[model samples]
Target: MLAFIKRLLIGRPLKSAELGEQKINKTKALAILSSDALSSVAYGPEQILIVLITVGMAAFWYSIPIAIGVLFLLTALILSYRQIIYAYPHGGGAYVVSKTNLGVNPGLVAGGSLLVDYILTVAVSVSAGTDAITSAFPTLHDFNVEIAIMFVVFLTLLNLRGVTESASILAYPVYLFVLALFILIAVGIYNILTGEVPQTLHTPIGTPVAGISLFILLRAFASGSSALTGVEAISNAIPNFKQPAPVNAARTLMMMGGLLAILFSGIVTLAYFYGIVPKAEVTVVSQIAEETFGRNFMYFFIQGTTALILILAANTGYSAFPLLAVNLAKDKFIPRMFLVRGDRLGYSNGIIILGLASILLIVAFHAETEHLIPLYAVGVFVPFTLSQTGMMLKWLREKPDGWVPKFVINTTGALISFIVTMMFFLTKFSQVWSILIFLPIIVLIFHRIKKHYDAVGDQLRLTTCERSPDIKGNVMILPVAGITHVVENSLKYAKSLNPDQIIAVYVAFEREDERKFEEKWEKWQPDIRLVTLHSHYRSILGPLTKFVDTVAHKAKEGDYQVTVVIPQFIPKKGWHNILHNQSSLLIRAYLLYKRDIVITTVPYHLKK
Candidate 1:
């Protein structure tokens, strides 16, 4: 029944040969991979206004200049990643690029940064999406964290089904969000050009707290950089695309960048022109929609799509995090379990871990977007700087065709990204100090894991001295309570192994019991000799363990192997197991830790 349910939800597990069928075309790839950057426009501009509103209503004008700077950075990053797509066509991303061009430690730092950033992407996107829903209903505000966690679980299960299935499931919402935003932008622009006042024009402005300054403006620009978070996901997951993987991935990245530029710039410009303020009850985008389309069907449509795409934007993380984890695991930086593929050929372990981590962040922060926003951009920009720097090094070393132009572009990108990374860190230092502490610890963990794998590899290595055949014969020991069908079956199986000798040992806690067993053994006329041992402490395993140890010591001295065969019973009902003492299980558990001791069990089926 459990298997049936799993098949029903996740579909039948595909054979390994079916992996090629899972590759997605450019259209589905765009929706699946680009949702993170595309969805950011919904809240990216508002993050800027959130900081700008601290000074006064008049300071809102600075959002335009801040957004322009963010847009310029976005373009540079897209171009740099496009070059990365071609240079490392096997989906190198930041970690692979840095590892190959830079040193190992720098590569690990890049991997750690991308890992943390992907987790935060899921957390922040889901939280912001939940905020959108709560703004509309207002009554569901209490269950925000619960709802966000549910969304994460849903995405996890969908992804476990397969990559193409998840892309198909998520594509519609992304398209809907794009359509809704375009409509909102067009109508808002039309209203402004015609000199017509909105129905909700007389909205109250927020009370100013302090005056604007250079520090505040820089901080606002840093905060708005959240729009650039998912831009590198395309290059990271280039293998998931159809034939000509890098070209398809590059085209998708270009399309995503163009959409982001238009939607982000248009939304920020319209919000400024309409004088929309960030409100506690409604969002900046929601307010813009309300002012342009009023409380009609179209207004609700825009809100609904915005909420959906933002929540589904977590899909972007679900796609990239697992692939990144596989890369890290391949390099021995993390556990090997993440390197194994699931029945559907996805990195099931990584997907589940990413979901759990995102859910933890949501619960810890109470699903508040403002609380998570400061923790967002820092992890992302670290990889941005590293990837560009790595690409610059690649060009200088290889000197391929057009390397000079590529080198110049990447050099400029590296400088800009490094400056922005520093600016982001300095502006949000109070909220982001935990990341500074967390990164070094993660790097240390990576080194420790590498050491462990290296040690295991060294121990398992084959050597000429250890390859000679054994000179002595084998001995089998059978432990029995009494001569029953179970014991008889075990003895027959032991004879099949053709050991040099077979010893039947019985631990007797009481003398009368030992006498009765000996009498029965003689009456049954079994050819095997029986050895009876007395336990003064009434402990069965203690005496048996000492005997086995003595046997193993003698065998080691003569290059022999001692096999312990025990008899067990299989009951029809699970509850019947409690009626049995489970002595065989206890014996096997104790003997397994000793080397060169073979343990085997023969089970006799019970009628009852």
Candidate 2:
């Protein structure tokens, strides 16, 4: 969907040459990896506001302290993950960490969290995009929910087409979003310092909560920490990096961390100084643009740009979610569908599923963005803390020289991450915490499913009973087009089955039908009954279906076993287009309704 949008609107999809090669170098890797992190510039602040929404107006200003706290936590977390990228860059992010230390369950928690978060990223971005569009075109204000859905469908298809292709196409728009943020921040800061604070700047909105309660503070911090959602993308995609994977991965992580920190902090500070709040209420930034750039210029362009950035932020989710799913499946968490890569080059099933899931949430909630924030952070941070903790565990296990200092750094990372995750859990997953509650429950279901499959596979020990045992009086009946080589092969196979009787049957389409009279039945099954039914009316499937049905029925009544063998050709012929086609598929479906009676296919490969 992303690539299609780029091609449709931006002239063409970005080719390999656009980035100067077929290989994913450090620049491409970082761009791809950092996208999730960098995209926080658009939504991180929004998440903070979302958490504060219920408490009322004054809580909006709390975004600053919240962001400050998250930034401190994120700095420590990023440094820890850098160590992760260094240790295991072949792909597996938290799965590797958890598996290496705490075991697969915790690893899967990380994997599941990453997977869900990636999906939320898409939903949040598109929902925010609806707001941007509404701000620009008031007429669209009524259709924000519908528009977000349409855009999500578009994005899902782009991902189905291919992630690398989609990512390459999105790189520029994402860059544009960051560049737009930079411009906004630079201009806003300049205006603030010049004592020319925009006229649109308003005093902070009123807080619904009366006091500085601990719950409100925690909620505020949780909202601001939304910026941290995409930091794990690099670890998930370590394999996509070029040679010296670990080195490249670490470099990419560092670059992403620094750039995102700068952008996220800058955006938060600008929003604070300008007194911009979420559009659900004042939509402060858009209003600020009206003052600074003039209503004529900022009204349309800024609105358009903000929408583009929000949409692109979701692209960051598209990139991260599938990677997490694949890693989870690789480590035996999710089903194999997550492991299935489509023809165009992505986890098409996973992409569509995520997109559809996001749409359901958006519509179900009526695009109530703030109401969904609790469900938002719980899964993301479980993996975040686990991965960080895993890194600390790994570093501690290694215990190299200068181990004390490295251990100290890792322990600090682990402690901070654990605290953040614990706080999110207590704040988000209350018995009344509807959305957050389901996230873990679903994760548990997947874990049970994985365990079930592994156990079944382990118990499937083969024995001789798997093959036909009551063999002495058994007979193998083969259906053939005629006495062709397929008939001869069937005869040879029947002889191997060592049946007391061998019968070859054919339902004649026409007396002159070459297939029914092509070869010598006498030479192949000379001693057995080679029955033929005259098809005076050319009804192939009906007669064949009835004949097989009669044979099975008679066998049941007579206490004899029956097996039908049909000769299958390698390729379809021209006439097959008009005939009762997909005979094998249809027959298989019909046969599945039966209790027993094996039906086997003998392929007659036409050597090319």
85: Cα error in model 1, Å: 0.5
What number of backbone clashes does candidate 1 have, counting pairs of residues 3 or more apart or in separate chains?
Answer: 0
* Candidate 1 residue-wise lDDT, 1-608, digit = tens: 77898888788888999999999999999998899999899888998988888886678878888999999888888999999998889885999999999989889999999899889999999998998998888999999999999999999899999999999989999999999999999988898888885534432334243577788888888888888889999988988999999999999999999999999999998888888889875888899998888889998999999999999998889889988888899889999999888878888899989999999999999999887877787888888888899988888888998899888888887887787677777877888888889999999999999999988887677852355448488888889898789998999999998888888889999999989888888777468878888999998899888888898889879888899998998999878999888989999999899778889989999887
Q: Residue 582 error for model 2, in Å? A: 9.5
The residue-by-residue lDDT of candidate 2 on 1-608, one tens digit each, is: 76576456433434434332323667766655576567656667766766666766555567767777887877877777777776676767776787778886677666666676777777777877787777767877778789999989888876665655666766776666666667777887798889888534534534344766777777667667767877777777765566777788888788888878877777777766666656663355566566567668645666677677677667667666777778777756678888886655466677778898899878887775555555566656777767766766766777777667656666776676666666666766562255456657866887798888787666574642354335225556676665577667767777787776767767787666634353566555557777676776875556666777787677666666777776665554545546546565566567666654677777666554
Q: Which stretches of candidate 1 lie over 4 Å from their true place?
A: 197-210, 463-471, 481-484, 504-543, 572-590, 605-608
By TM-score, the best candidate is 1
Supply the TM-score for candidate 2. 0.75
TM-score for each model: 0.91, 0.75
